[model samples]
Target: MTVRLRPHHLLCLLTYIGKGYSPAFIAGLTEIARRVNAGEEVVIVTGPDDICAPLLEDPDAHCHNPGVQIRDANAARDVGALLDRDIRHGLRMVLTPVLVAQMRAAFANQDTRSACARCDWAALCSDIAADGFVGAILQAQDSTAE
Candidate 1:
């Protein structure tokens, strides 16, 4: 059956994945979203726990069973850590190019901005220097250039 997709539904989906739900659970959620979007009453069936609490809080979010999954704390933590590590490692591979480019651009912009703000050629250098030496080499370069 299908249920209409909503903000809370997406939130729960993300929250569940973040909380280290199994691949099966993640696939189930994808089907649920598809069914829901197709206009079926998709009910998420998961054990009760803090992990799924956010979905429970939403009145519209329905579940078959509402109670915590009775796993030992140590087991749960280990599983959570393993899942987190795997997921992050996967993401690092997938996102490395984009993330690296973004970081490079950000660092470059920061360097330029810092030089512009603290360089001797910068209008505010007098004020900045009075406070303390800031990015002095770049400032010196700017002064020599002028």
Candidate 2:
């Protein structure tokens, strides 16, 4: 079974180090990070109801079974859709110079408020983005290094 990951998932994989969310969520994210670090292609589904639903409903997965609200799910789906669109347009890999720039621009743009407003790590993430994403990526990599 494949998991359709979003830009938020990419952000989490890059910055999360055993903080926020459940342990299961952290572990799942870590696994995804491992795949990303290994240069794996993270597939992303296109529709709102396709991938986010199962992720929200599964206990051993992203949501820990409590089931995410519609708003949250929609937000995640929208972020994923944006990431997928960027990827299709030659953003071949996540964390590349172009992709990072795109992510930073998306976060900084006022129009994308819904993407970050609901995030628990928004303040810190915004600070990280503002300060420079390379450091944040390295910090996350170092923190997760085995």
Candidate 3:
């Protein structure tokens, strides 16, 4: 099965470390991370996606926020440029080790962080990148090209 994701989530998965708004949210994201690391196909979507699923029922959910949409737009732009592919809805891919490694390199350099502006988790993600992604839950299952 495929994992449905929003563009910004492409960044979030890079720094996931078993934390989130709630236990259920963490659990849901953890499962998604597992699937993604296992080489599942990923399909980009427009709005609230698998990462937002556990919080969708909340009255204050940020899934549909304008800022969130902006983040998505920024992510699409950044990741699309990095991959040289349009990172839009229905764009399909597998996050191979080489690709993930390249993304991580860009992330570590803050090259793809326009999508993280105003995000509550931005600092944590930045720290994860700076720390060489230690303790991150979603590790590539193979050696990176480096």
Best by lDDT: 3
Q: Is candidate 2 or candidate 3 better by TM-score?
A: 3
Clashing pairs in 2: none
Best-fitting candidate, measured by TM-score?
3
Clashing pairs in 3: none
Point out where model 1 deviates above 4 Å.
Answer: 2-20, 42-146
Of 2 and 3, the candidate ahead on lDDT is: 3
lDDT of 1 by residue, 75-95 (tens): 233322433432211121221
Residues 21-52, candidate 3: write the lDDT tens digits.
99999999999988988999999999999999
Per-residue lDDT tens digits of candidate 2, residues 1-146? 33455434444444444444556555665565555555555554333322244356556554432223333444455555657554321123544444544544565553344645556687866665565554443122232345
Q: How does candidate 3 fare on TM-score?
A: 0.95
Q: Is candidate 1 or 2 superior in lDDT?
A: 2
lDDT of 2 at 110: 34
Model 3, residue 39: C-alpha shift (Å):
0.9
* Model 3: lowest-lDDT 10 consecutive positions: 137-146
